[model samples]
Target: MEKGIESIFKPYLEPKEVYKGGKNIPASTKKIYKLSSNENPLGQSPKATEALIKAAQNIALYPDQTDIRLREALVLDFDHKLAADQFITGNSGSEIIDMILRAFINEGDEVIFSNPCFLPYSVFSRWYGAKQIDVRLKDFDYSLDVEGILNAITERTKIIFLTGPNNPTGTYIPKAVLEDFLARIPKNILVVYDEVYRQFADAEDYVTALPYVMQGYNIVGLNSFSKTYGLAGQRIGYCYTTAKIANYIRQIHKPFLLPITSIEAAIGALNDKEFIANTVKTVQDGKIFLADAFASLGIKYWPTQANFFIIDPPLPEMEFTDFLMAQGVMVRPVSQFGAPGKVRISIGDQEANEALVQALVKIKTR
Candidate 1:
């Protein structure tokens, strides 16, 4: 390796063992159930699958440079408060995050977020040379500390990353709290609302950050078809912001950011309201079943509004996660996301949920 190579690129954040599959998996294990990533347990919409296949026939051509169709579908199907021109499409939510950072973050600028946030917030901030300000979650409920964030603000602060139904923890900011927080924030600083799992959130008090954008606030709402529509492999996501910010991101973004098939699949998935409903229902039911099993087993877990929840296993985090994996179930040990001694479990299908409970029972007995 060259001696100066380290200085040229940022270090990569290595994923955990569950993401690095096939290394420790037993040879005799059959039908491994993957519930690590918060994916739709039910498969993709049939309409989306068909669109993907049909779009593949013209794979030789470039996708629409502006991605007008997908943006229009997003507005017409999900959010109509903002026009299509206000949206910026990307390969994934990760890419949109990168775009936002690139467009707004300059070297030495400050970025604020809670600890145990979506891991990429820090990674991207470091890559762009932004000073990170991590506010610890409240001790009791692990919710974001709004007052702490307000106090952390400085003249150099550029962006604040807020995740509703935050990854790993699945804790969300309530509507009133969020409204009050936004009202107090300095308008010069941008707020990024990461809502990839918004479709699965069932809490009555949960609210989308889209209306703030329509109200001409300095906020960007990020969403993805990956979790909601089973399009993770397709790598498509979008963000809604002010037209001015959208233009700034677009000016620096390369054209054809998404593939033709991915765009078509999102459009088709949006049309299939029935599939979305069933996916939401399946996750909700599995959440109840898993929560009940955990309670009966005397295991403690965080109440979640999203498709996944964090649980404190009887053993160490990795030990429990490894045991579950050996039993053909994959759950995420979220020490990397700052919740040590806890494991995050995504809601799975009926069979997978039952299998997980059975494995947990075995652990309890052992």
Candidate 2:
């Protein structure tokens, strides 16, 4: 048997369970509200359809090996001096994360980030044979522990993953605190800011780290068209960084991995300003609506800036999730993301929110 296969690999293996999260549903289900995955329930942009239709005949030919169209769109969107050599498109956000870790880490190097961060961030670090140093969050809200992350670093520390409008928790690190944190860290260490929900940040405090990239900071930003653009099923994501790091990432990644359709959709999504604006408005409104509902029910929840928010469960997270599911509401159980007692709910459209509210009310009454 291969040395890295079978039992030696078995211990670290994870069974990815696919649950019904609003993306797939039965036609006969009543109301059929889906609040899982933190995706845009508002539907995709018309521009995407137009592009896909235009590109349909081109699939027989290989997708642009370099993914030029999407890269151009991203560079234009960022409106910085990013050269064409500075971006790499991938199968999904997950693939980009994998490629980056593979590009940097060797055996026994250290990767420091936050506890209760993105579920797969730690997974990838461990997969790449790096020691994972987790800085615990300040509170149940899961804010970044900048000082702890700094203190955790040593000569062996190679990478740090920072998530803004952080998943499940939805808290953001302000620019000043980030500046301080960045200033303290050695410039050679790589900082990955997962700004997957950057579009949804309405507050001025929610600044993205892209400016760091333009300034040639040792920082990389990962983004997915899945959440804001409703393209999760299409599996398109990209990383933006300084040309040097991006070239390294490109060399480590599988070439021609992205399909033409996904790239086409991503390009259209970039140009769809109305779609971004509307998605942000809906998610922001949905967050407020859910927060108010939680307050009315006297349920404590972490205030958030992302599309999803975390609420401490009145019962085990799984049990509350099941009860909500039975009541025709679907949400993410945060156990996989390192919070066992909190459930993360994606703010859905008006009807779905009303259903979730009614379910919570009934559950509270009982």
> Could you say which candidate leads in TM-score?
1
Reference-based TM-score of each model:
0.93, 0.92
Q: Model 2 misses residue 341 by how many Å?
A: 0.7
What pairs collide in candidate 2? none
lDDT of 2 at 325: 81
When summed lDDT is taken over every stretch of 10 residues in candidate 2, the lowest stretch is 12-21
lDDT for 214 (candidate 1): 78
lDDT of each structure? 0.87, 0.82
Clashes of each: 0, 0
Q: Where is model 1 more than 4 Å wrong at Cα?
A: 1-29
What local lDDT does model 2 show for residue 296? 88
Candidate 1: tens digits of C-alpha lDDT, residues 139-252: 568898999999999999999999998988889989999999999999899999999889878888898878888788898899988888999889888998889888878887
lDDT (C-alpha) at residue 345 in model 2: 86
